[model samples]
Target: RLEPGGLTFTLADGAFGLGGARTPLDAPLRGRITVEGKDLEGLVAVAMGPEPRLGGGLKATFSLAGTAGRPVLTGEVALANVTVTETNPQCPEPRRRTLALPSVTLAAGWEDGRFTGRPLMASVAGGTVTATVIAQVDRRITVQLGDLAIRALPLERVLVDFLCHAQAVSGPLDLTGTAAFTAGDIPRTLSGAGQVKIGAGRIVGVQALRMLDAIASVAGAVGTLLGPGTPVSSSALAEFDSITGTYQARDGVLTSRDLVFNGRAVKATIAGQYNLASGALSFDVVAAVAGRNVRARVTGTAAAPSVSVVPASLLSPGDAGRIEKGLQDLLKRMR
Candidate 1:
């Protein structure tokens, strides 16, 4: 016992099974009910609110027998070395960033109103993020997630922890998915469908490959075709071996019709629409400049986008004045 609002209760190694009476819930119930806590940020701010701020240490276990009103709860719940700080709508004022979940688990079962977690593991960064939740809890608490798995996960920790954005890629990310949401608005009730594979990668600062190297440096060509010496550093931009994709998201709007970006002097193909909540961008790239095929069009909003070159009469005029002075010095060094 350690109440006072921080939570802690235990009732271990128990028993209670008497003369098959029949009634009084038919007497017969074993036990083990524990719930410890160290600092779960007030139960995760009473269930995910208060602007993402959850800390570590918490344990749970419930393994009771069937008896009291058909009681029977399986157990397992753990959270260690967890951390989450939030707010990085794309970074700036040190736009908060914490995210370091060394481990987490939740083997579940609860029947009735439902609540299953066949496996809900997590150990990000170093990778290993399984999933298979259910959570129905009637009256409104839907949360379905199936088979969704991601191995070797690590793509700059999913772009700086859940897409807060920041890239300099380095691969090892495999995925398989299925999702559903509404556990109190998970990013406007997420939706999903996926298949991604990336192993052996290197894409520095990707923003649709920096607007396809500023549309091949404003048509003056040889934007190093995306690779070729003199950039194995300086934040090397391309050096791929492969990248595969297949995705579909809903509410947050993400789509793809086949994305492929091979490297060692570029070779692209991408079709898309992205709008992870208003970062809007409508892609359509098909590269391989110099040897032929070169089509482009990337609309604005992943923090100022806009690339052209497709029947725009192969743009010229010193390639629109060096692509408007390299996009005003890349948005002035991204502000």
Candidate 2:
């Protein structure tokens, strides 16, 4: 069995341990770990077998320290075909999710009351998930993710579970992009914003095509979604290339660029901001989508993000009005 102490127990060479059930790493991990401290210290390692093609083994060193009432964790974790799961007591039912992990490799450093690291992803399937993250113990969490590849993913199913952690319905989502998350303390807020460039893949109710072909007529509708139908055509193969977007994080709020459905041609951009903090995190954004003049001006606060759609008539021929309104609303909402 292994326990939560300052030790690294492994079986590669006789044995290595860091306190949890006392079982070694190379052997099947059927052990238990327990730690009770505002401050923690420990080292962990997994034994390596003989074959190089098999795996490289794993090792990690970590510690939790605090000063002036602020706490921080420092560590490094490396692994192959390993699982990183949080052992919280709240998981009474076995249905709990471990945030499934395959290969684990990370080199991290923590200080100034935060937890930071450089983590990489070896594989993912649904595109509905993200893992590599840097957390600030006292404040926020920053994460960057690559694109995803899913098949026949139900948009509604993915949306519910993703937004509320509810039961996951059966469907696949193939997505690719970067994301950032911020966890709030009071009122228990959660902020997340990211952009994805989805390549060609089957979606439950989505049309498939090449991305670049869709962006040809974006200029036609650069003001409002209710404007004249976009005037563009594309033949995106849904294979090469991807959509692009921006994600921002401030305090515990998240803001995202519009979802450019295609490569700027047949879809309108959807930008929004949310605050998972104390008060409210509301914000707005504006951009042309699907060659339609669509945009919105929104504002709120880091604690309360908001959004407001800008009518097409108020937009300038060049769509500059929509852009200005978006920024203006963003600042005003913060008030």
Candidate 3:
């Protein structure tokens, strides 16, 4: 029997269960609902299925209003134990594993075909991230990421997740950035700007530190003045105390400026452009050590970058000798 009800009628408030449902990704969804006339509320819980593309547990508390065709929703979404598997064919086996994300909290809303979220915060392995996001009906999205504080975050994890690299670098990372793009054309339409700072980190899997070690050895020979101990190992790891830089993205190319890295025995200033679409990298790095400047050109993909160091040069022979002597004297006192 069907009873006809008016356009407006208050719904009885009670607990209700919905099951055997699936989301757009075909993930299993189960929820409980409570309703009162135009105002409706529900708690939807999602379970990770066999989907390899996405796996995570999510719980959302949402309130809805208006008719079924045009409804407004406001809610807070929380994500836990989420893991996104790498799907790129070029990614190595070591980097193909799942990338785990820390728990996330989002204040979200949807109205008139537009979605918005603010104060989206996450607590990850070594730091905290907060951002704001907005997506319009036309499929354009904008994101603003605030200062993300990093403390002792594992370099391997960061590389695999963000840079799509399997190499390891250990350190604390601090950064802030913003990005905007249309979902219709992702790689080409993406644009962003950011500043990054890494403190007390080591770069592994590259011989970029060899020049530093050589300089240190030369300094050590002069008046028994020891340079910063050889932090570079045979396994190709270079240790650095700090790196700071600013970056901008336009037309799929990310350009870095005023990038500086302070190593144990050498200091480097880097300028480069990375192609977001092709993963190509071209960097001009100048390493200064023992009063000599060594220019290194780094080119290739992020997955396997190549570095070529030019011959070291002295700005002025007289000045170089004086500087070398001053450094030797300082090292002697430190000893």
lDDT string, candidate 1, 1-335, tens digits: 55432768787887777677478776877889988888787677777677788888888898988776667789999888988787776665677777788889988888667889889999977889889899888788988899998888778666744554633466788889898877766656678888988877776555646754675464344334322433222223366776888988887677888988776666678898877667778888877654446687888888678887686544434656776787788899999
Candidate 1, residue 203: how far the Cα is off, in Å: 16
RMSD of each: 16.0, 15.4, 11.2
Q: Enumerate residue pairs that collide in model 3.
A: 11-37
Q: Which should have the higher TM-score, number 1 or number 3? A: 3
Ranking by TM-score: 3, 2, 1
Error of 1 at 302 (Å): 24
Tell me the tens digit of each residue's lDDT in model 3 across 1-335. Answer: 11111112223332222233243333232232221121111111122233234445555666655333445667787777655654555455564556666577888877778777776777666567777777776544544344333444566566644445434466777777877776546567668788888888777533334433544444444323323443333223166788889989886788997899887756889999988778788989886644457577878876657766663443444656776897888899999
Candidate 1 Cα outliers beyond 4 Å, as residue runs? 1-28, 31-62, 65-67, 76-106, 118-128, 137-149, 153-178, 181-197, 201-239, 242-248, 251-262, 267-271, 274-282, 286-288, 291-309, 318-335
Better of 1 and 3 by lDDT: 1
Ranking by lDDT: 1, 3, 2
CA lDDT of every candidate: 0.73, 0.40, 0.59
Top-scoring candidate (lDDT): 1
C-alpha positional error of residue 111 in candidate 3 after TM-score superposition, expressed in Å: 1.5
